[model samples]
Target: MKGRILLVEDDETFRSFLQTVLEEAGHDVLMASDGLSGARLIKGQQFDLVVSDLKMPGKSGLELFRDAMRDADPPRFIFLTAFGTVEEAVGAMKDGAFDFLTKPLEDPDALVRVVDRALEGLQRSRDYLALKESEAGGLPPEELIFAGSAMQPIRKLVHNVAGTTANVLIYGESGTGKELVARTIHLLSPRGGGAFVPLNCAAIPENLLESELFGHEKGAFTGAVQARLGKFELAKGGTIFLDEIGEMPVALQAKLLRVLQERVFERVGGGKEIRADVRVIAATNRDLAEEVAEKRFREDLFYRLNVFPVNLPPLRERRDIIPLLTEYFIRRFCRLVGKKLKGIESEALRAMKAYTWPGNIRELQNVVERAVILAQDTVRAVNLPDALVGAGGPAAAGRDKLKMVERDLIVQALEQHGGNRRQAAEELGMSRRTLQYKLKEFGLLG
Candidate 1:
């Protein structure tokens, strides 16, 4: 039950005292003096929990909690307050703070008990996020919803090899849910009770990617103030989904191949070897064989990871499932956004069916969510993007026409959202980074 924790308190003596107690209880503790300092650390690092004083210099604990909530996955927060601010602390808890404690600790064991409870809850949350469907009685409903004939064999293959411990490599384009396939395998495997840690090889920088996979000891680098566990360590006795594996740097590929061969790795700067008892599931959109021929990826590593391959067909190839996916996304988004939508109109559905999805399932989900948000009771053609209207397919138009349509949609979405890039991107069913790139390409962002 050991976890990394962050403690924030203005009282220097009390901070040291609490750190001692937590560390003695087998928790890795990081300390900050005040709310501002704690906020800075929270933004830069990931922690299991945050313990901070409700009232401190500069920002308050509540403000820090709000900022932390901006992250896609945020740590639990526990606020400490004096008797005079009990009401304020309760308000913070109602606003989604994990728990609250009063000042002047009488029972030392109370802190230990609270910390234990918080970490236990966090473990459950992490497991739930990773194994939402598989942990349930069986595979998730979405996995079964692919009723198309093309998906029947893929579904059978998932069931056939899911219970094994062999490494898996999934080949598919972006948005085809490679991670979903990996999760299904893990959930059905013997390691379902353990963690399912996913790392995007392309998302992280090359300089830090090694430490992220293998971890680092204290003073391993300039910012290495404390020892940290890596994704492999966290995923011990479970599955590690190495997403976009083809994008991993060539230097790191050698180390990864070593892990597959030896089942061991060393910390970034530490000489001690650690055991890795985890199953690896890698996914890529690129033809790794071609990359190997080009000498961009290690040939040994490619063969090691491709022990059992699963290929996912693109959305256009499985067009029969579009309606099913569209319906699924509509229900999900309506419940998520509290819209109470019925369904997409016939015209909209026809247009959607005709348009070849360039971004595949991910783009479809985004479009459906946006349509749900903009709809009254039923989604209509107006809710969809211009390119999707009266389309034979995405590829039917030339590259220039597609670009013009995309630019127009981006401009309209931006204007509708009053120039808020985040909202505009969300509406367009794309990432903020993608939106920025498009804006730059179209000369829209002045």
Candidate 2:
């Protein structure tokens, strides 16, 4: 994770030595001869971390740090001090300095380690802010996200790959919550403190996709009124979620492949190379393997992105959790509409579980919201969409069929758990009391 660093020191030789070390470690280093000059630079530019001498001519390092703190976003600070001023450096640490290095450095590795830690802390701060913004934007709770048995293994896989820097390729049908899974991975990983930038490749036009990914300089194109940061730059030290990656044009795919291979990219019309320094999590509804076989997608790019593959089972395969999801949506919609409803009627829940959710959870949420608006007290069969209720006619045989299907689900869950009622109830996303009542109603308790 390379960062922009500001180096402030009074000794020219020491400053040059420190600059060489930081640049060798892949950081972009800006130099200042003294604290006054450092203060001016801090006022003009942004840096991820600052390394400064404890004492300097004219303005002191402590004064510079205090002045920088007035900015909206201040950089992390590390001070260099002699044996005598070690106490002053310790005082600076208490005042929010990152760390201090004793003069006549014992080992250069120590400086590298401290700088890396400070930059990582900065990334985490950024990630925290981004997470709060996402929460305010209405991200669902983790329980609701991994609500069904089908998602249990996926949850584990997500946790496993999140800690590493491996590129992830998620395969699932549309509306199967791929982006949500990507966000979860970002939040759990070491880089969770960074931004999570998402871009839908299929949504943008081919002519503009390059600019969207790599940004563009002022006057780069006809509509380029000013320079703009692209998704890659915006997601620096974070994760970039490329949704519908298969839809990326072949030409743009080549550029993306280069970025992945080299960890560097040039803007749409710029000559300077910018470091990517970001984790990639790409998702597609299409079968990327088949796309690669047919020469539609580059094989190299596929291999690069498919380091870790995650498959999300559709909602139809996780039908047992329909009751849980329905209850969640009902309560959420009830609150939004300012209505106090008992809940969904049993027949409506049965219809939901019996029907194959071709549109998955997204469709279910929309249906529940609509039902909440239409229902006077409890969401019943009539409140549901015509397609769901009309499939089962108003006859005893249809009701009997729905009841049998519900009973089969309970039996399967019980059998799968070796008759442990608690485990079975959890797998079915229901309370133990509800499961017990169902078992008796279906004459399975005997």
Candidate 3:
């Protein structure tokens, strides 16, 4: 919980001593000899807490606190007052100051304890706000996001990187919850109090992509109705999640790379440069290295966004968590649809676990929602999709059906690529070795 602290005291010796103590206590301490300088710093920068002597030259601690209160998110204040001025410190507390300390300090541990409490309180407030935001956005709980043994390493990676300003690149198949991971990282970050803006790179048209990212001034293009702020501007002091980043045009990748390099960008058709001041978390389902080798994506941009890579395991890889996720989504959709169903039947749940969820968790959620709507009491094999029911029913028949379907898919891919194993593997989203093994398994090697 180390934090940036502003310490203001008129007495040079006392100020230096206080700075030394706070610094030793793991705070980044900034000192100001008088209240005027403290006010200037408060106006120009951000701090977690402010510690100022109640009586100071020029502005006075009370006046500085009052001035700082004008900000929307002002730092918490702790005033230092002499025994005679204890009443004034109490009054400042009534006016929104965090707490106050009497002069002729009794113990250094007291100051450290108070500062720790204040920082912890600040963190709690941020966490609460982030929680509200996530709830409003329909985000799942943190435990659910990190559920299953396969995600343990990913959870650790997220925890390690969330505290820093590094760019995060999440790689996973489509519907594998890349945006969910991005939002989780944002909520766990120092900037959680700020906005979390997300944009799908592939969803936006290439013609309008630049303006959507950097914004556009009035009359920037054909439709010149009014000025608009882009995702970067809206995400200031926070994070911007670029989903499906591999779909971004190569030309736009260069602009994004520049923003990462220089920390600045200009509005479309505008000359003024604005500081990025935004953490970037980009996600893509495609093999970016292959895309780069093919010249579809820029190598430089790829390197810039790939600072911290997190690859999410697809739902099929984590079949052990199917029941957990199914129960979660069942409860969630039940609440949404006003259903009082108990839960999915054992056979229905077995069906889900047997099916290869090509669309991952998102597809599973959709299926559960639909089943909840259709089920009268509890979800059963009858209420589930045909494919799932068949897959879970009569083990021999299910296995034969799955094998036939898989064999057909492999044959089609091979035929489409004129028997080129490499091209067929690429088309099927599998390695050539895996395709070769599958061919042998299906007796298609001949």
lDDT of 2 by residue, 45-98 (tens): 999999999889998999999899888999999999989999988888898999
The Cα local distance difference test for each model comes to 0.85, 0.88, 0.89
TM-scores of all candidate predictions against the true structure? 0.60, 0.62, 0.73
**Ranked candidates, highest lDDT first:** 3, 2, 1
lDDT of 3 at 71: 98
Candidate 1 vs candidate 2: which has greater TM-score? 2
Candidate 1, pairs of clashing residues: none
Compare the candidates by TM-score and give the number of the best one: 3
Q: Which of 2 and 3 is the better model by TM-score?
A: 3
* lDDT winner, 1 or 3: 3
TM-score of 2: 0.62
In the range 1-446, model 1's lDDT, one tens digit per residue, is 77899999999998999898889999999999999999999999989999889898898888899899989989988888899999998988898788888898777678888888998887766555656554243233545434688878887887778778788999887887787788877766667667889999999999999999999999999999999999999999999999999989999999999999999999998998899999999999877886797798999999999999998877878889898888878887877788887798999999999887868888998898889989998999999988788475555567558789899999899899998877999998999768865774575745
Stretches of model 2 off by over 4 angstroms after superposition: 1-136, 391-446
Looking at candidate 3, the ten consecutive residues that score lowest on lDDT are: 437-446
